[model samples]
Target: MARATLIGFSAVAMWALLALLTDASGSMPPFELSAICFAIGTCVGLAARIFSPPPPVRERIPPQVWLIGIAGLFGYHFFYFTALRNAPAVEASLIAYLWPLLIVLGSALMPGEKLAWNHVAGALLGLAGTVLIVTKGGGLAFDARYGFGYAMAGVCALLWSSYSLLSRRFPEVPTTVVTWFCAATSLLSLVCHLALEETVWPEGAVQWLAVLGLGLMPVGAAFYAWDIGVKRGNIQILGAASYAAPLLSTLVLIAAGFAEPSWRILAACVLITGGAVLAAKSMLFGRDAKASAGAGA
Candidate 1:
């Protein structure tokens, strides 16, 4: 479980690069970029399969898995992009990033899972930290004009949280199944691109490389790692820790000179890190600390 949780963190780490990479990739349409990147992600899985093929029975994966998987990947992105288009980027993103908090709260419904004080507290802290990062300590004034985008952002949050929780329900399903999900998402994205967006390909070698990097890491291996973590790892901890993505992303952007350094970044870092530690107190200190405290008492 610990190992799988660490693997999940790797996904968060990769996601930190998402903003940087997307910025580097030229102004391609969202769906078109999604299609191309996901196609590369599909190839990544296919390449892995060449060495270690899935079991014959794994090929007959359930239809519901397909539905959930595609809905999760493509649905989340579609709504997210729509939300960004219809609303202010800062407001839309702040609303969409509620997934981690939703996951922490929703985990109580999962079998054998117990909601704890620290979990809720930590998740709230993480959400607060994320707000600082997304809004840069500025106030949010949501206008009715962008209500549709705000609603779409809310849906995006629910879809991602639901997807994460649902993945836990199918522990028997192999992570390799994400490959097919990526393939289907890529195809669907292509369709959406054709219908809704003008064709604008990556311009130069640097943009192309950025697209490839996105496909290989954030879009590709990240999903595979996340599946394993949600299925077998400490999900509550993972949920709280997910807030680190935006914080880290901001830092990455600052380091790359795409963004400026700010005090809010430091505050967000402290909050996010502290929240993760608080949420993972059990795993970090374990029974020995409890025993020592009890003995001392």
Candidate 2:
């Protein structure tokens, strides 16, 4: 559990760089960037599969699961890169972080999971934080310029939450199936890029580094580590812990001179983290108390 927790945290740390990397990609269309990143990830996945021992043939993955996985892997990155292009990274990241809250809320739809009040409250608080960030602490004038981008970020959050929730329904499917998901999305992204976007190759070390960084971390290895954490560790802790990514990412962006620190970002951080903790507190801590009580009695 401890190892998985550490791995989960490491995955989050890798993810923390995603916003900055996406922005650093420089003028590459979202579709093109997504295609490139997933292409690299596909290669890594294939290589890993080739070296690893094969599992039982009986654990056949269903086509429906394949469809869902592809949709999720493709949909999330597509919206995410587009959001980064359309909106400020700080705002886009905070908004994108809403997935944890959504994940908690969406879990109610799962069989054997009831809708809890704290979860609802947590989601609402997170929503409030998103509003604060989008409104720029109520200072930004109403305009269409970045609204679509913000909306795309919202969609990114929704797609991810939906993916996470649905993933819980099929524990039989190995996480390695994400490799196939990557392959499908890579192909889809390439088709979209060729049809709709202007291709721009990375021209310098910094730009190429951004491309490589994203392909290796956020899109590739991070997913594998996260799968281990969620499947092997205490998920509530990992889920709540994930709220740190936006804060960490924002700080990195500021440190890189890509963004200026602001009260809005700080407020959003507080609200989102607080909300996630509140939502997951029962699963995270209440189980421990129950176990203690059982042992004492």
Cα RMSD to the true fold for all candidates? 3.9, 4.5
How does each model score on TM-score? 0.95, 0.78
**Alpha-carbon lDDT, every model:** 0.91, 0.75
Give me the candidate number with maximum TM-score.
1
lDDT of 1 by residue, 107-196 (tens): 999999878889889988999999999888999989999999999999999999999999999888888889999999999999999999
lDDT for position 67 in model 1: 81
Clashing pairs in 1: none
Candidate 2, run of 10 with poorest lDDT: 288-297
lDDT of 2 by residue, 1-297 (tens): 556656766888898898899888777877888888988887778888889888877577888888778878898888887888888776776678788777666666667666677767766666676666556676434346789889999999898777767776776777788887888888999998999788888878899899988988887877767766655544444555666666677778989998888988888788867877776566557765465334324
